[model samples]
Target: MLVHKRVVRLNEKPRIRYGPMLIRDQERIANLNYIYNCNDIEALWMLRMKRAPFARLVQTFRSRGLLQDSIHTSVEEQVAMFLHVVGHNQRLRVVHNTFRRSMETISRYFKQVLYVVGELKGEMFKSPTGRTPTKIRTSPRWYPYFKINNIL
Candidate 1:
């Protein structure tokens, strides 16, 4: 048996440039501060993960007075909570342990906020203009996988 050796290009240094940091505009900064200061863990989580849905949920909750007397958690906190949950997908107890809050509180707040998000997403998806056309005519063999996959 003959053995062959392979040569590798190991001397190529990657050209990397660190871009300058971008500062937020005054209005955007103010809005971010307001959201960060005013939202709760659940609210913040929904906002960060699904901005449009979160906004809709917050609006609905505000209109219904559901959040009027609730604790003064900032939108930023809510966003942070969402990121934490998404990053960990752990149990409620795990979330509570991580967030330093009781499981009951986390569950209650998360459910309420998520309910609103679900409703908003449903409504948005139900709109006729939001859907793709059922019949999309394409040339035969243009996408062979489409025929193979029975999608054509």
Candidate 2:
């Protein structure tokens, strides 16, 4: 304990040089190339949706006048990052590493996409009506019971 306190020049922390993506301009360009040229399957693998559906979703967002490209990032990339994080249950740092973005960028865009998509999601989920649907009503097994209900 005495030696630890007496140690000199130990307080100067080493300068950390971040590797690859986070530090270079070229890496950011490559990130664009990745999603832009990636095939449907690859897009699905990374973003949890195929290229066509991804494009359509972006188009939907654009058409609604909700989201737009930022100075440093595009709407597509923003959405992709958002989807990748949520779809894979990843943390912000994971997304930052994968997307080659800073934590701030990842968080900002994630929130943006989340807010916009959440805003539009109301259309997908309608209020439940107090009625049995045609499928349930028509299906005897489902409406009445799936099993014998032996306990009852």
Candidate 3:
């Protein structure tokens, strides 16, 4: 009887070149500055908001303590990821590729940003008064079947 044997290596080490590397803070800052310097149209296409409005929104978030930079990522990148996910309805995998972040990190920050926005909902919205003008309210009823309050 003849038998064939297969050999396996037990002492092999995992590859380091295939592992992920941390993005430098300077690179992130430079990318963010370029985006911030873009024209209104370009900014709208990239972030789904005009440059001025986006800056104001970021400022508001910072002022309200709703967002901050993580040790590995900047506030601008986080905000951009959030907006990109929203504007394009992208999947987590796609977001990971665009932001160069792990799926878990992207998801965690996405949810955190959503939570912060929800927390600010009250401050962001104004209650509707549903009031009619005096002229319309005091006007003689042209049609008795129609009522302003009911219509509203």
Q: State every prediction's TM-score relative to the real structure.
A: 0.38, 0.66, 0.64
Worst 10 residues of 1 by lDDT: 1-10
Query: Residue 6 of candidate 3: its Cα lDDT?
Result: 23
Predicted structure 3: lDDT = 0.75
Best by lDDT: 2
Models sorted by TM-score, best on top: 2, 3, 1
RMSD of each: 18.3, 6.7, 7.5
Candidate 2 residues lying further than 4 Å off, grouped into runs, are: 1-23, 125-152
lDDT of 2 at 49: 88
Expressed as tens digits, the lDDT of each residue in 1-152 for candidate 2 is 87776574477676798786545667767876898689988887888989888888898888888899878888889888999998899999988877778999999888999999789888746886756667876787797762344234
lDDT of 3 by residue, 1-152 (tens): 12222223334565567544435445545666777798998888878989887877778888878898778766667778888899888898997876667899999888987887788889867887776656666667733333647486
List model 1 lDDT by residue over 35-116, tens digit each: 4455466434534444555565456657765443356444434434444566557677876655555677667667765665
lDDT of each: 0.52, 0.82, 0.75
Model 1 quality (TM-score): 0.38
Rate residue 93 of model 3 by lDDT: 94
